[model samples]
Target: MAELRTLARPYAKAAFKAAQEHEQLAEWSQVLTIAGQVTANKSIRQLLANPGLEEQKKAELILEVAEDGVTEQVRNFFAVLAENRRLTLLPEISALFNTYRADLERTVDIEVTAAFELTDEQQQKLAQALSTKLERKVSLAASMDKSLIGGAIIRTGDLVIDASVRGKLTKLADALGS
Candidate 1:
């Protein structure tokens, strides 16, 4: 994982620079996402590994088959990856590119975990509260956990707001122990 990040950094940086220069960051994001997804598919891996196919031919076939939004620039990048045998790293590249996007946007993804699923109004209120507190828009990813028993926990990077019943019990237990 760490090694993959180290191996992926240079390629991601190069691709990000190219995308930024051409004002195609968003477009490339989608393109890379699709390409990454394709590369993740077992059938696609098998196809890429076929001994009967030429590398460039395989790449071209891929370009045509995964033709969701194959722009010339994205095609060139894919060709470069194909040539370098780095096509398998598309998922890491996408992850790095998203990190770049988040850095550029000064936003972080927040997760809100609750004992039960949150309603739309609850989500909106939580987001609004977070936005006001952080002074930046928050993208909320949420999950339900019955083990939490009650309340919700909000997390954004180093910040955490744990209002869970489990947390409260832990606090009570700790206090009694102390």
Candidate 2:
């Protein structure tokens, strides 16, 4: 998984640069997402892996399977990927591209798991507070996890705040064991 992301990073960066230059970040994002979904199809992936099939043909097949509105630049991007035999990396490329887009837009996705459901007002307040703390727009998704016992866990990117009763108990156990 890490290797795939490493290999896909350059392609994703190149696509991001092109989209930035053309002021078509949103369009390119959609194009990459559609292309990724197309490549994720098992049958399509097998066909693309056929040694007898030409690179251009594989790229053409993807473009056809993808929805309409793909621009000339996006088609060319596909060709490059097919030529480099990196078409299989589309899923990673698309994810990286979206991460770049989110960073540029100053937005972060947050996940919250708690023992119980959070009300709309509570969610809104949490989002606002996180937005202020992170200095970025927050998109929060809340879920109930009774196993947590009480309190909640907040996760965003590489940061995690584990405040649940289960987490506390585990910590206390570790400290006592040590």
Candidate 3:
């Protein structure tokens, strides 16, 4: 999976550059979403892997499935992938493209899971707090997870702040051990 990401990064960067050059963030995002959805569906997976079908036929099926959202440029891009047998990288490309988009927009998605449901005030405050810490606009999604026991866990990128009772107990145990 990591190696696939490394291989897909260049393609993703090139796609992002092209999209940025054309001011096509929304367009590319939509295209990638559609492509990712299609690629992830079991039917599409079977189709992509079907050996009985010819390569051109498989490529045509992909284009057909993607017709609603794909523009001419995207179709051409898909054609290149079809020729190169790189269509399986759509999922990785979709993901990396989003990473670039977030970087360009200076935005991050933050997930906050609390033991109990957060009030509107709490949610807004948390978003504000995280925005300050991250120094970027935060797109926050908060939810209740009783398994957390108490408090909340905040995750953004590689940084995680665990303020739950469970987390504190573990931390205290580690502190005592060390």
Candidate 4:
């Protein structure tokens, strides 16, 4: 998985640069997201892995599946990937591209799981607090997980705050065991 990320980084950076130069970061993001989903399909993966299939055809297949989001620039990007036999790296490239986009946009996507649903006011307060804490615009998404028992777990990027009762109990158990 790390090797795949290493191999995909250059392509992701190149795509990001192209998107920035073209002033179409959102469009490129959409195209990459669509292409990634298309490539992630099991049948599509098999098709991409077929040695007999020509590179251009592989690119075309992805483009056809994601036609709604494809632009000429993105089409050319796909062609480059296909030529280099890096089409299978679309998922990693898309992820890295989004990471780059989020950084440039000064935004973070936050996921919160709690024992119960959060009210609109609660969510707004949490988002405001997180925005101030992370110093980035927060896009908060909330979900219910009864297994949490109480409190909530907050996740954004590589950071996680496990404040749930279940998490606390697990930590207590580990401490006692130690």
Candidate 5:
């Protein structure tokens, strides 16, 4: 998986640079996402893996599947990937490109799982707090998990804040066992 990421990074960076230069980050993001999903399909994966299929044909199929989102820039990008047999790396490329876009936009997506639905005021307060804490614009996606009992768990990238009652009780039990 790491090797795949390593291989995909340059392509992702190149795509990001082109998108930034053209001021088409949003459009390119959509294009890449659509292309990634197309490449991830089981039948598409098998087609891409077929050694007998020409690279140009593989690129064409991908472009066809993502026709609505494809632009000349995206077509060129796909051609390059197909030439290098890196079409299978589309998913990783899209993920890396999203990471780059988020950094550029100074935004982060956070997931909040709570015992109950959050009120609008609470959600706004949490978003403000997270924006201040992370020093980035925060986009909160809130969901409820009754099993949490109370409190919430906040997740952003690799950071996790487990404030749920279940989590606290588990920690207490471990401490007592120790």
Candidate 6:
């Protein structure tokens, strides 16, 4: 996993930079996302792995599948990836590109798991608090997790605030056992 990310970083960064310079971040994001999804299809993966398929043919197939989303810049980008045999890294590249785009837009997506459904007011308050805390626009993805028992667990990027009742109870149990 780490190795793939390491190899994908340069390509992702290059794509991000080009998109930023051209003021086409949204278009590039869409292109990468569509291309990534296309490559992840079972048949597409098999074709990509087939040694008999030419690199140009593989690139063409991907572009054809993502016809609506491809631009000239994206086409060239795919060509470069194909030529370098880094096509398998599309998923990682797309993910990293999204991270870069979010950072540039000063936005962050946070997942909030609570014991019960959150009210609109509750979600609004949480978003406001997180926006204030992170100095970024907060987009909440709320879900119910009955196992939480009570309270909520918030996750954003690498940070997690496990304030759920189940989590506290488990922590207490561990402390007592220790």
Q: Give the range where candidate 6 is weakest over 10 consecutive residues by summed lDDT.
A: 63-72
Model 2 accuracy (lDDT, Cα): 0.92
Best candidate, TM-score-wise? 4
Cα lDDT tens digits, model 2, 1-178, are 9999999999999999989998999988988898888888898789888999999888888777665657788888988998899999998999999999999999999999989999999999999999999999999999999999999999987899999999999999999999
Write the residue-wise lDDT of candidate 6 on 1-178 in tens digits.
Answer: 9999999999999999989888999989988898889887888888899999999889998888676757788888889999999898898999999999999999999999999999999999999999999999999999999989999999999999999999999999999999
Error of 1 at 63 (Å): 2.7
List residue ranges in candidate 1 displaced over 4 A. Answer: 65-68, 133-135, 155-163, 167-178
User: TM-scores for all candidates?
Assistant: 0.79, 0.92, 0.90, 0.97, 0.93, 0.96
lDDT score at residue 33, model 5, on the 0-100 scale: 91
Q: Where is model 2 poorest over a 10-residue stretch in terms of lDDT?
A: 62-71
Per-residue CA lDDT of model 4 for 1-178, tens digit only, reads 9999999999999999999998999888988998899898899899999999999999998888676757788888999999999999999999999999999999999999989999999999999999999999999999999999999999997899999999999999999999
Q: Report the error of model 4 at residue 56, Å.
A: 0.8
Candidate 4, 69: how far from true, in Å?
4.5
Clashes in each model (backbone N, CA, C under 3 Å)? 0, 0, 0, 0, 0, 0
**Candidate 1 residues 78-161, lDDT tens each?**
788778877778778888887787777777789999999999999999888888888776899999999999998989766899
Q: Candidate 3, clashing residue pairs? A: none
Clashes by residue pair, model 2: none
* Residue 131 local lDDT, model 1: 84
Off by over 4 Å in 2: none
lDDT of each: 0.82, 0.92, 0.83, 0.94, 0.94, 0.92
Model 5's TM-score against the true structure:
0.93
* Candidate 5, residue 133: how far the Cα is off, in Å: 1.0
lDDT of 6 at 166: 99
Candidate 3 per-residue lDDT over residues 43-138, each given as its tens digit: 888888877877667667766765665676777677777777777788888889999999989999999999999999988998898889888899
